[model samples]
Target: MKKLFTLTILFFSLVAAAQTEDATSSEINENATFQRWAIDVGAGVHKPTRPFVDGYVSTPDLWQADLGVRYMFTRSFGVGLEFGYNNIQSDADASVTFESDYYRVGLEGIVNLGDFVNLKSASSRFGILGHGGIGVGFLTSNARTLTDATDHHLNFTAGIAPQYRVTKNIAVFTDLTIIGTTRNHYGWDGAVLGTEVRGFEGLMINASVGLTFYLGEGTDPADFAQDPIEAKVDAIAAQMEKMAIENADDDQDGVPNYLDRDNTTESGVRVDSKGRAIDMNKNGIPDDMESSLNARYASQSDVQTAINSANAANQNQIKQLINEGYVNVYFRFNSTKPTTYSLGAINTIVQYMKDHPSATATLTGFADEIGSPEYNKSLSERRAKMVSDVLAAAGIDASRLTQNGDGEDASVDKNSTDARQLVRRVTFKVN
Candidate 1:
């Protein structure tokens, strides 16, 4: 009995060492929450194969019960301690009839097979568990003639349990197990085993139905936890989706957000590779648009006649064009740089300031409703300052020029590109 106990201790020590190694090597989610403790109870039938006296054989009996507690180190592996009881009886027709009571206690290693095996059904409510262990067992005779006879042995147990989850905290399971014993002196019929038939020669099979109750505050049990690798894949997919959105070209201006200095460039408007409007001549209008505007105005004889005239009416007409915003300087979306063709409008202001030295002008800037009102207000101020700088550089006195930002002009349909373009401008008021 001492030797058997020593061997059992050594076996359990080895199992603990192996379990520690497996736990350290496995990948686990440190942040995930799950139930790790459970209680198992079962009732079963057992069949024992044993050494019986002549004409004496025991029949299979449905008198076995088991109770156990388990703790999972991870989703896939765990350990358990269990106690079991079994009753064996001889057939009534046997020449020599006997009865025995068997009891055992074991410490076992458990594996969640559904988690270890890469099955498609692993995510389903059905699962499988495999367990094995070394333990001690005692068998005592129930006959009056052999009241002092008992069999003491070391036991080895192995089993598989197929289970179905009925709820988050409960599951139903069926187990099939084989128990093997060694170094038993007495047989089931209360007879001593022959000296030659000494080592490990006892076997019993058990089939049981049971329930497992999980105990923890978490809603997910360790058996049903998500795979760490699958969770990482999901995280990576979400990051890729965010990257796709950040890199998208919202304005369809042929440039991604990171590289686009001007995000709201008008469609069909010629732009450089960087997505800024192209103004090769350094004028207030884009080169592609300057030609068309020049052609349209060149055929207008009345407009030309007014510009060449020096009379009060022609001067008033030009001033009215500037003040009324017809001759205003246009800008690209979200830019302080005036369009190349609109440079002529600044020259018109400069000429008027020169002709009437006593006159002053106020340059009020306006922006399209593309951005926040506060941001557009600041942008409008910068646009007015830019136009004021141009006039100062063109010899208009700083004292005679007043710059103001009217902020966003929301009168037009904000969804219309043409209307938005028509509003990003700086108009003059001659004082």
Candidate 2:
């Protein structure tokens, strides 16, 4: 009895140690909630082997019962305290007849084979566990002739259980276990095994079916806990998929499909970041050219006076507007094509060149400070070339148009989208 009490203390101590070790590990996800405690109960048949009276083998009987409480430190590893009872009797046809009652208390280290092998990916409701432990057992004779004779021994037990989850809190399981004992003072039929019989004097095999009841705050049990690494990988995969959807450009415009209002803009047509064609005015011409024409001829009387004065002052004014960045052609983010609102600026430059047949124009392109210096430099060159192409298409001689890339404009705050849009432009220098 004293040994039994001591073993009980050792059992709880080992359980505590296992839990402490698991708590300190970095792999454990502290925020994950699941049931970590469970109660196990079972009953079945037991057969005792060896160390029995000659011709007195134990009979098979439904006389074995066990109960245990388990704590899972992780999904894969745990510890349990179990108590078992068995009623052993010799076969009626045997040479000798006897009946004995057996009892044991053990501490088991449990490994969840299903979780250890990542079987959850294949099946969530099926699982298996392997367990082994050592404990103390007491065997006492129930035979009338040797009622006072008893056996005290140290026992070892190992078992495998296959379980099926029936609900969130309950599961059904079947277990097969072998128990071996040493230091037996008495045999199965009440015969005394003297001190000479020392090592592994007795053995018993048991098969049982039982139910496990999970206890905790959440519906998920620790047995079905997800692997932390697997969970992280799933989260990253979801984020990447979302980014792919958000960045898709079905119209091949500079704008992403998610923000594009017009997904089927014709090729080479100028558009805004929202993928809308940039024709702010109802007039057939783009708004940029309309605005330049409106600014150039705001006063009809002054224009007529300049025309009567040989149009020199009027040409100088137009030249000043083009050179001072007032009539600049603006583009959308990362696009070489001028915006629909800025198309009028190209027409203004074209008109100025046609009016002064001997004049030549320089188109210097610039980008916002968003990308690498080298990429921005390339983008700016493309913007200048695109504007020069439009000018050549409009009957302006290509030889009269010189394109230059000024790279990124660092004057404005890079974080401001409106300010950055103002700088992604092509400016004119008409001679």
lDDT of 2 at 131: 77
- Residue ranges of candidate 1 with Cα displaced over 4 Å: 1-33, 54-59, 120-122, 144-149, 191-197, 217-219, 239-431
Which residue segments of model 2 deviate by more than 4 Å?
1-24, 27-33, 58-60, 145-150, 194-196, 250-252, 257-270, 282-431
Model 1, residue 135: what's the lDDT? Answer: 83
Top-TM-score structure, candidate number: 2
Q: What is the lDDT of candidate 2?
A: 0.77
Q: Which residue pairs show backbone clashes in model 2?
A: 288-341, 288-344, 289-344
- The alpha-carbon deviation from the true structure for residue 202 of candidate 1, after best TM-score superposition, in angstroms, is 0.8
Query: 3-71 in candidate 1: lDDT tens per residue?
Result: 443544554564476567556755654224668898999998888876555425556676899999988
